[model samples]
Target: MNKFDAIVIGAGQAGVPLAKKLAAAGWKTALIEKRAIGGTCINDGCTPTKTMIASARMAYMAGRSDELGIHIPEYRVDFKAIMDRKSTIVKQFREGATKGLEETKNLTVIYGTARFVDPHTLYVDKNDGSFENYTAKKIFINTGCTPFIPDIDGLKEIPYLTSTTLLEIKEVPEHLLIIGAGYIGLEFAQLFRRLGSQVTIVEKSNRLMPKEDDDICTVMSDIFDQDGIRVWTETQVESLSLKLGKVHVKLDGGGKGPASLNCSHVLVASGRTPQTAALGLENTGVVCDEKGFIKVNKRLQTAEQHIYALGDVKGGPAFTHISYNDHLVITENLLNGRHKDISKRMIPYCMFTDPQLGRVGMNESQAKEAGIDYLVASIPMKNVARAIESAETRGLMKAIIDKKSRRILGAAIIGEQGGEIMTVLQMAMMGKITADEIRSGIFAHPLYSESLNNLFMSV
Candidate 1:
């Protein structure tokens, strides 16, 4: 029998940091993971995806060498080499995580599947069919999530791909049909399209990135159209059939009859679901929602008071950074007696399409829904010197300000470096910095960050 002051299940982004914090605080901690450490972000999701996106961006730039007055030469994408680089990055991060955990004196890193035997007891199952029992004073669940595979007809029978499997492809598909137009879908669409694949996106929602502001979605739609990626909005996949090395999709919208599209490959970027089914929550007092996500309070404490849940398992924002923030908040509450609620944090989101889209705090629609008196100002990318110099001036930057308080209520950017630019806005919103302050701040000339200055100037 093994016992510890805290037991963390799944050593991913959230679990790894929390385990370290608890152990460093002199708590006896056991970090258990069935797979590699550093979770999806380090191993598969964010790191690898972004690495591949970088390669794809380079490929895009090479194709447009004429704009930069570069010599003309034909280039081919080595998909296998790109995957190799991504793999290398994943491996390096994994090793760093392992070494960090191994050096912690008060922490035990266990590689096994952990299942709840009781509210405070768990059984770890090893691959060799061996089992070990563990009891803890507290437990933290950060198992994260998995791709949600819909049960479309013949989807499983065909060689369908998800984000996890798509990264393993050594050769680019001749034609790729993607279902869903959220972040995942758009990202893969841009990557594969730049890699010389004909990409088509079918989104059930009426707009791309339905969670974002509609104006941003409109800009993204235009960019996709200009890039030759076919986008079908408000379309539902009725069924899928495989024939002659091609995928045939039946889609329906409005009262129109079913329309069909053919493609050499199909990728499902629908969404992800919390990975809680195998944890045997029924054996413990922990409660999960209908979708199998563990329920947690403002402090991330589960129904079992001694247990805490974070990241995607808590059914909140499912981003890698969000999971890291979850670790920070929970660690503070558990170790320092500080009461930090996850909801109180300023959360930002981004979609990495051609003209990236990013937002922080209440958007214009949300301000209206909340009945807040707000003023909005927008600046076109063409007016930004940096955007013009970079020849990527095809988006907009918008700011929402509280009319009474003059505080920045929200800011959205849809242009080059939108994700990076949103960080400045996130800090401002978090610190309650007003729009007038932002306007007074001097910005570097010929930089995309200056768009914020321009946006406030428009106000």
Candidate 2:
């Protein structure tokens, strides 16, 4: 048995940084990873998906070039090239993350599956077919999540793709049927449609984005419709089977959709489930919720105070940036003698569709549900000078403001460069800047930022 000062299972965004920092602070550390370094974000999730989205965006823009007075004879999407580039970028990022850990002093990188033997002890089944046991004074579990496979009948017999497996397709799908209409499903729906696939989205929810405000969902639904993607809401996928070299899907509910459909490929993007069951948590005091997410406090500490849980495994915001922030909170509280609680931290996220959906803080519905007296201000992209000039005017900008305080509460930007534009608003909210201040603020002409001045004018 080997003993260390700290041990971090799963080398994700949170685990990597936390292990490095702990080792740098003079505590011996061990980071055990079952697969490649960098976890899902680098190996499969964010990095590869965003890279392919960029390629899809290029194809989409080329197809729309006629509106910009540019006559392009022909353009084709080289699916192999796109996949190659995604693999290349993923490899680069994974290599970089691995190198960072390799260079860290007093930190041992173990490639294996770790299971808890006790609160402070773990046994690792190494990739080399050897067994090893390590115990630490402190343990951190950053094991991330995996695509949740639903229990639809006949699903196991047929070959279906997941978000991870979808990236490895040899050729563009002829017709892709995606399950779920959350951000993951919607993004793939648009990207595959752009890649010359007949894409259809089936969502169990009544609206496309149930969490978003109605106006936002309406605009997104309209945009998807305009893009020639069929959307079926309040729909259930009863069963799936392979027939005549095509995937036959049985549909129920959502009266408008056909009772049966055929597609070349099926993507199961329903949701994500945590990778905690295999960790043998029953051996320790750490508790997991019914959904298998590790229960943690505001400080990210598990019931076993010396053991901490971070990243998607701990639930809450599952974005990569949030996981990185988890590392910051844990490191500051432990190494720097500072108490930083993430319960009140502002979270910003972006959905990379044709026109990105950027969101920060609460939306109108959330504000109302929380009983906060808030006022709303909004402007369409068609009204923004920059959007008009770019010929990419499609979505809108909306802000929720505190009624009496005049402070910007939350914002959503769904347009070209929406993520970048939303960042400006997030900074304003962080500073407690008022709506009047933003309305009267002078912004450079014909930029997306200028739209902020107009967005807040209504308030």
Give the worst 10-residue stretch by lDDT in candidate 2.
252-261
Q: Which candidate has the highest lDDT of all?
A: 2
Q: Write the per-residue lDDT of candidate 1 for residues 1-459, one digit (tens) a residue.
A: 798999999888899989998999999999989988988888878898999999999998898889978966989899889999999998998999899999998999888899999999999997667889999999999999999998787788789899889988879999999988878888999999999999989888778877767886687788888888999888888888887878888888756657998898899989899999999899988898999999888889998989999888889778888999999998788778998987677778887776788888888889999999999988888898898888888898998999999999888898899988888888888888888888888888867887677788899
In model 2, where do residues sit more than 4 Å from their true spots? Answer: 254-258
TM-score of each: 0.97, 0.99
TM-score top scorer: 2
List RMSD in Å for every model shown: 1.3, 0.9
Query: Candidate 1: what lDDT?
Result: 0.88
Model 2 accuracy (lDDT, Cα): 0.94
| Candidate 2 backbone collisions, by pair | none
Query: How much does candidate 2 score in TM-score?
Result: 0.99
Instruction: Please give the CA lDDT of all the candidate structures.
Output: 0.88, 0.94
Please provide, for model 2 over 191-231, each residue's C-alpha lDDT reduced to its tens digit, 9 standing for 90 to 100. Answer: 99999999999888898999999999999999999999999
